[model samples]
Target chain A: MTGPRLTPLAASLPDTVPFVGPETQERAMGRPFRARLGANESRFGPSPRAIAAMAAAAGEAWMYGDPEVHDLRAAIAAHHGVTAAHVVVGEGIDGLLGVLVRLVAGSGDRVVTSLGAYPTFNFHVAGFGAELHRVPYRDDREDTDALVQKAREVGAKLVYFANPDNPMGTWHEAGVVEEMVAALPEGALLVLDEAYADLAPAGAVPRIAADDPRVIRMRTFSKGYGLAGLRVGYAIGAPALIRAFDKVRNHFGMGRVAQAGALAALADQGWLRDVQGKVAAARDRIAGIAAANGLRALPSATNFVTVDCGRDGDFARAVLRECIARGLFIRMPGVAPLDRCIRISAGTPADLDVLEEVLPQALRAAAG
Target chain B: MTGPRLTPLAASLPDTVPFVGPETQERAMGRPFRARLGANESRFGPSPRAIAAMAAAAGEAWMYGDPEVHDLRAAIAAHHGVTAAHVVVGEGIDGLLGVLVRLVAGSGDRVVTSLGAYPTFNFHVAGFGAELHRVPYRDDREDTDALVQKAREVGAKLVYFANPDNPMGTWHEAGVVEEMVAALPEGALLVLDEAYADLAPAGAVPRIAADDPRVIRMRTFSKGYGLAGLRVGYAIGAPALIRAFDKVRNHFGMGRVAQAGALAALADQGWLRDVQGKVAAARDRIAGIAAANGLRALPSATNFVTVDCGRDGDFARAVLRECIARGLFIRMPGVAPLDRCIRISAGTPADLDVLEEVLPQALRAAAG
Candidate 1:
């Protein structure tokens, strides 16, 4: 018998994962990595209060999580100084990006982003049959001018920009971001992804009116709150745009335990400050290890440090391969120029010790 | 400045939630639900092993769950006597259905289901711009022949049939299901949702070959496993179809604690057996309560029972309202014939005492 006929769009899409998780690599290698630093996950654990809340909520696993996500939304709104109607929570920023793409970008609709921005967002845009137009990064940071200009030229529906950018850990000042928001063409929404906002320097985060219809910004608990495994992220936008998410979202998708954990995590700002301190220290340690190995570490405001291999993409690839072979997990950008760098997330002091020991060996092996 | 313009389809769709969560009602009423029976959650709770596993995993929440989901997928495969290639895990069956609809049913593609089938599935179809066609239930069961006929007539890409169906608690035997599968149109896939399979009779689940490309069957931890709050569900199908989910799914969507909890829950089938016994006992208790009140309980193969109010949809709705007003949270079907009944989920001995106390008063109020 013939199988079901897939839609042309589905059939045309490549079966590719945006990120090959470290677990897949571990399985292929037949051993676990000594240091889990890939994927930019927090090496520091979530707040103890969050852990306790989740553990307590475990017994109530028989009931569905609140579909409206009432308590968490209220708490998030208070944290951001916005009304509840301005916030929408989803599985994660990745999931919310997919829904946001579906909401605005129809088949053949033009969407714009930088060449080396989050591949997951590009995956969503392609999956929805939208035409993606990407501009090259100007100087390892996303080119704001080129992105907005491209959006205007294409009459784009959505434009994606991440502050404290991934892979490079570089950021723009709040004023630059405000200019980008102001320059966004009519009918083109700016998807200002502030996933690393919690760790960003104070002046790096732009302050836009909550009701500004020009932008929808996403933030995640995965980074600063150290709850990556909880899969909670949210968007703050104009009320109308936020309400539109309910039309398509999986209403009861959030887990009850996750809700409790996030609530407790949000309440523990002291723990967040502690993580910020640890992350900053870890970033410096990673940079020091990079310098010892004769590689250049990029300036970073986020939790991770991106080290330039001081050579081409091929050399960086070899260095990355050597590190993986040496039981250290790390990643490099897929695009050129940027691919000259290897991205390393902040790890514990012990994990960093492994990195310091392994880097010289890996560099020597790569050179050979 | 104007907001981003929504795609024509998204603009046409009205913002709606598939189900109003009990928590929302509680907030409006200024109290908690005395008996939360509306959502068909397992009051029996998850296995203690699962709770323990999740509680332990909570401390590891900083690390993202393995996106490959290797261990859990392998375990689920072993349990079903299928290779891991034949399985794909997701946030829930609701989330999986959304992806499946996107994979096979493009905008304007025809899909068939019972008029009063799972509203969430319908929401996904609508969200993706697929055209949905509904058939009426026959003898309180899904009309399999009608669904198949309509699929052939309209060249439908998908047909959804839930055995031990929601809202009505009716199911078809294995033979009937096999016949229906055989009758699926050349390009139409059958979405056999077995959400309540663990609680169904011996012959209710069909033993389809793993490589059979004509159908995909979904199972969940939400119902019989008593982990509704965990949000873990899986689909078994042809390897090619299962792999296609990766192209569009949120690859790292499944939470770490959720994966651990589900793995532990699957290992402890003894807990499942215990839950089955409890559900069966509660079903009997609910049926007795209905009989005592001079109402008819539909013979159920599910964790919930549907009791006919012996009048019209209006009467059933009135009864439901009274039940809600009395601090009992229960639901009625949204469509006619089915709407002539109110559905109640299995509860603890203590919870059923509330239902027992409240159902009679609700009926009396409706009568008045």
Candidate 2:
């Protein structure tokens, strides 16, 4: 018998993940990478308190987590000086983006983002049958002016902007982002992704009013708190917009251990400070390695550094291939211009030692 | 200024949670429940092996979970005597139901279920703007024949049927369910939710062909596996249907610790057997308590029992309220007929002691 038919929209969509994880790559390679710097995960690890909290909550997992996510939201709200009504906790920024897209953009709706920005946002837009408009980055950073202009021209429903952007490790000043938020077209939502905000310079992240209706600032524990595997992220927006998430989100989605871990992680800001320091040192070490290899490292406000190969995208891709072959897990952007730079995350000193040992060899191989 | 405009369908939807969790109730009462049995969770707890695995994974929470969920899917597939291609794991059945509904049923598409069946399924259908057709339960159990007939009548894309149904904890024989599966409409997919399958009697679960394209069987660690807080569930279906989930699912949604815990939980079948025995004994104790209070406990193939209060829906609701007032967390179904019964979950002996003491007082108060 024939199987059930997929909806026309689902049938038209491709079966693809936004990012192929490092574990999948390792499985294909038949061995683990010596240096796991890809995926931008924090290798310094979560706070000891967070780990302890998770371990403590492990046995109590027979019960469902609080569907309301009340305590965690309240803690996050207190941290941001906003009421809990202005925040919504979700699986991650990735999952939240999916729900936000569903709540605002429908079939044939227009969405705007940088050409080489986060692919997951585009994935959700396409999954919902929305038309995506791409604006080219200027000076290796997301061009907010062009994005705003494009959104207005296309009558877009959503505009995705990542401060301390991925793939290139570039960021905009807080004032510039505030201006962009204020300039968003009527009826358009600005998805200001701050996934890397905690690692960025203080002045680089804009302080928007919690009740700002035009923008939703997204943050995650994955980057700063070192809880990527826990899958906790939240968005700050107007109370009404935040409440709208309840209309479509999986109520019991958050794992109880995750909630406990994030709560502990939030309470342990000292651990976060330690991670930030380690990330800064790692970034400096990565840049030094690139400089010694006769490559230029772009200035970054994130936990990663992007090293320009001083060549075309193909040449940089060859360098990336050599690194992967040498068991140094690294990634590069998909779109051109950005692709000339290879991205590497801030890992522990041992991981960086592996990278230091492999970089020259990879460059020589690519040159040959 | 107005916030970003919600899609017409999202705006029309109400802000609702399918189930009000015990934590929410506890918050309202400003104290913890003496006997936590409202959510049907296993107070017996997860396998010790699972707890240890989660504790081990906690330190590595810095890494992103495998987006593919490879190892867990392999383990699940091997347990079921099927290839890994036949399995798709997700963030529990609630999350999977949302994706399944999105894949097959779009706006205006018809979906069928029992009138008081799983509300989460209906929530997803409504979230996607699909029209829902619900048939009333037959003899307190889900009427598979009526659901299938309605699916054919309305050309429904999906039909939801829960084995050892929730709320009532009643079930049909495997032989009868097999006939209903074979008779499903040509274009309809049957969502066979076996969330309580492990607690069911031997021979009650029909063995369907692994390649059966008309049905997708959903099982969860939430109930019998004692992992509701972990949010792990899986669906077994034809390879084509299984792969289709990638189109819209959050690939990295499953937490790494959860994956590790479920793997260990699967390997420790001894723990599962022990839990099953505990569940049976707890069920007996719950029934005894009901009988002592002059209430008739319905025969349950699941971990919870529905006790008829020998009165109307309002009377049962009063009984439920009294139980809650006395700090014994219990729940009753929302609709008529089923509302005449109060649903109590199997709990630990000490928890049951609290229930045994308070239930009579609750009954007396309701009578007054």
Worst 10 residues of 2 chain B by lDDT: B1-10
Chain B TM, per prediction: 0.99, 0.99
The iRMS of the candidates, in order, is 1.1, 1.1
Q: Which ten residues in a row have the lowest lDDT in candidate 2 chain A?
A: A1-10
Q: What is the TM-score of chain B in candidate 2?
A: 0.99
| lDDT by residue for model 1 (B1-368), tens | 55448889898888989888999999999999899998989999999999999999999998888888889999999999999999999999999999999999878799999999999999999988899999999999999999999999998989999998997999999999999999988878999999999999989999899999999999999998889999999999999999999889999899899999999999999999999999999999999999999999999999999999999999999999999999999998999989999999999999899999999999999999
DockQ-based CAPRI category assigned to the predicted complex of candidate 1: high
- What's the lDDT of the predicted structure labeled candidate 1? 0.93
For candidate 1, what is the total of clashing residue pairs? 0
Model 2 agreement with the true structure over A165-198: per-residue lDDT tens digits:
9878989999999999888888888999999999
TM-score of each: 0.99, 0.99
